[model samples]
Target: MPSRSAAGVDRRTFLRYTSAIGVTTAITTGLTACGGPASNGDGAKGSGGSGAGTIEAGLSYALSTGFDPMITSGATPYAANMHIFEGLVDLDPATLVARPTLATEMPKKINATTYRATLRKGATFHDGSAVTAEDVVFSFERVLDPKNASLMAQFVPFIDTVKAVDTGTVEFKLKSPFALFPSRISVVRIVPKKIVEKDVKGFDAEPVGSGPYKFVSAVREDKIVMTKHDKYNGPHPAKAQKMVWRLMSDPSARVSALKSGRVQAIEDVPYIDVKGITGENKVESVQSFGLLFLMFNCKDERFEDKRVRQALHYALDTEKIIETALLGNAAPATGYVPATHPDYRKASTVYSHDLAKAKKLLAEAGAKDLSFTLMLTDTGWVKDVAPLIKESWAAIGVDATLDIAKSAAQYAKVDKGDFHALAAPGDPSVFGNDVDLLMRWFYYGFWPEKRYGWAGSAAYKKTKSLLDQAAGLTDEAKRKELWGQVTDLVADEAALYPVLHRKLPTGWTTDALTGFKPLPTTGLSFIDVGRA
Candidate 1:
């Protein structure tokens, strides 16, 4: 195991990474939740549930967690706060539409270097301050600041600058002819300029937003409570006055809470619990964009060889992970980057579970007694399946020690390139349907640390060159043509690999809530809910 800088990503791999690609620009609307027959609302009025008064929902996330979305990292916890915070625009889960939130509509493209956006009418922050062009510009600037340590900064730094032109409009300038601007806008979740200015420390204290819900109170590590803001000016009615977000850490405990009627909703249901519940016996079965995978550190000397990489790829059993580990709730996949996104590349130059090929490649590479520490963290999927993988690899003469990292340590390790191989999940956005992000993350020669997995591969230089050519091609036909070639090259040589994947599932008692659609990326949509 070596750091990204220590692993040798040569110039060749860098060229290939730059020239490689897959592009996606849009997302899908989520699933719909209709009240169930076992519903607790008891036809109260909406959903036949008595009436919408106070909705008590249980989230596996602890409250009092910091307001830093990028810091939190994981999909479940990040999504909990995402429900309350909003940005310049919002993705409508039902229609796969991007609607104006703080801003009224899409930004106007001025030229290859700049674009301008018009603000929405009468949008105000929860703190009584009017949200205007200034706030939008400030929000983007804050995230881009290196000191802020926003994980989002890695993606947004491409833009040269963001500025306000007038009262209702703002402008953005990019260094190059970047086209995925809208997709980037979708993730830069807006924060109130007033709140951060007042006290950066108190940001977690009910940060103001124009969303339908307002932060009420929260206890660190336990739960966060949000009440419906009366001043919310949206098309829908917010049924529940108080949204009690309970932070239950245990997955089984979350299930128990749902069964006992303690919490109305929970996300990230362990795949093991899916069959016992859902009943098909009438609860809504939520199929989300939940993607799970094993990450290889190309920074490691052992993984530098392409044959070794391919051998490792073919040794695992994805179908078994889906059936035995996930129980048919997910799809066995290979590189569904920007998972479930509308424009992601589907036809793979890189998908095969060929064990024989894997064995042959290992022998060819002279990788005798191949072994490394395979780091995994505690979770339903990993806990159940990491052992199976260890055994699978062992049978293939590759010994792997299952080293599990604690939550905090795990986050630190991956971000710092501290391990050889680890199990990590990525819910990434590709503002453009092209492969800039795909290539930069996996194959960039200059930033081995940034290249998702191939940071230390010997072929990095060549990969980066290919990526530059792919990105520079403004011609649509040739760009796609070059992208196809890039895809073929990486499918054979790169380090980013997908193991087993499952659909993210959320549990909600139909009695107290309505309009709960589960998104693949984020956990739940708060604005869409109403007193049912």
Candidate 2:
């Protein structure tokens, strides 16, 4: 089981809460003024003079998890880790292309199942400890250790062993040949073995990594702060002296923060405000793999039949949800991956809104008078669409009781197999953009095995086999072909499938920040961004 805070929500339930405290802090703190100074007594001092000033930005998600990269799944903390941590290889925050971080370059292939990487010379952690090969091995080992229940463990299942070949060199031996090994290893960030072993809990709260920024302090549903790591010698050095990420879950608060010049950037820009904000700031709605999905509890007898699952999917008027709730900012999901994805291939079964078809499927499955409580997270946009979802199902004579709550509470129920159906947002593209990585995020690992209760089914076995087969193939066409098959299979089954692939709208000021680019996935990245 994944670790949860006292609030019973795992880090994975990112963007799940709208805290009154966050709104109150935004209002009472007087963040409305132009060019407000950094928080009083923030203690963020750095040697990066002149051009480097504090970069204040507004983040939409509350801090629901710790900073530990191995276990964190919260969107805000994950974005914070991007500035605070580094992998042997890391995805470019804006483009998601894998690039060498601690490693000299991408890991060099030694054999079919072996790869080697040498640490960058003079690379040191935030605490000034030298980044060593042993630390790299320790990082991967901890994630691979099943007892740890790392959220990232499912991303790197091919690895068999990782060992320090020398003081500066680390080697990996895979259980099988995996073509994406070099880039895939980006999922595991290197951590100091000595520090982590001494105090894992403290380390999770205040993580120490070799990235360009160092963690400072964080207040749940309030704010998170970081300072530039002056000692960093990596490719993307922190250009700003310090950073303050305000946890503003309210959409209007984020908009007000950006418009009032309190924040240089803000993510998850409410679609309704796009036109209004674009006149004053830079707003871009990039097509992303982030999606609102419909998931069923397969263990529930009413949903055991594939027809029942498909019927629920067919009942959704996804286009209406996109237009009414999202204000034309999202697309109906055509496949497992968004149609904008490079490896996208349309699933054979496309459930365009058909009330009659939904009725027929329910009847065929002997599921008449189908009634179940539909659970959902109270994300701003998700709340706007929840009633529409119920209305759609009602049209097919299926009564749906909407159970809307915070993300943590909902996922707590989900992980315990206590729900009939769930509609929530997910985006694995934050980790990587490849089809294999995205598909495996939901279908292959903890998801099918634990959350959805589909692990023992024959379809689950076949889906896993196809993903494994795709992972090993070096031929691009063959891998894509296999992925397409898996997409079609999952789409037809409709066990856990995306309802719509939403666009990620981000707002930033051109004059206040330089070298800033909106990420296509969830969360904002300020890796190379500097205060103007």
Collision count for each candidate, in order: 55, 1
Best by TM-score: 2
lDDT of 2 at 41: 36
Q: Write the per-residue lDDT of candidate 2 for residues 1-532, one digit (tens) a residue.
A: 1112211224333222212111111112222211212432322333444327788889887865667788777678888899989999999987789999999999999999999999999999988899999899999998898767666777888899999999999999999999999998898888999988987766777788999988777787788878778778989998887788999988899999999888889998989999998655989999988888889999999999999999888988988889999999999988988887878999999999988888899999999888999998877788899999999988988889999987768888887889999988877787788999888878886788888899999999999999989888989999999999999999999999999988889999887777889988778898888876
**lDDT string, candidate 1, 25-55, tens digits:** 1111221112111223322234423224555
Error of 2 at 175 (Å): 1.0
For model 2, the stretches where C-alpha displacement exceeds 4 angstroms are 1-51
User: Which predicted model would earn the best lDDT?
Assistant: 2
TM-score of each: 0.81, 0.90
State in Å the error of residue 173, model 2. 0.7
For model 1, the run of ten residues with the poorest summed lDDT: 1-10
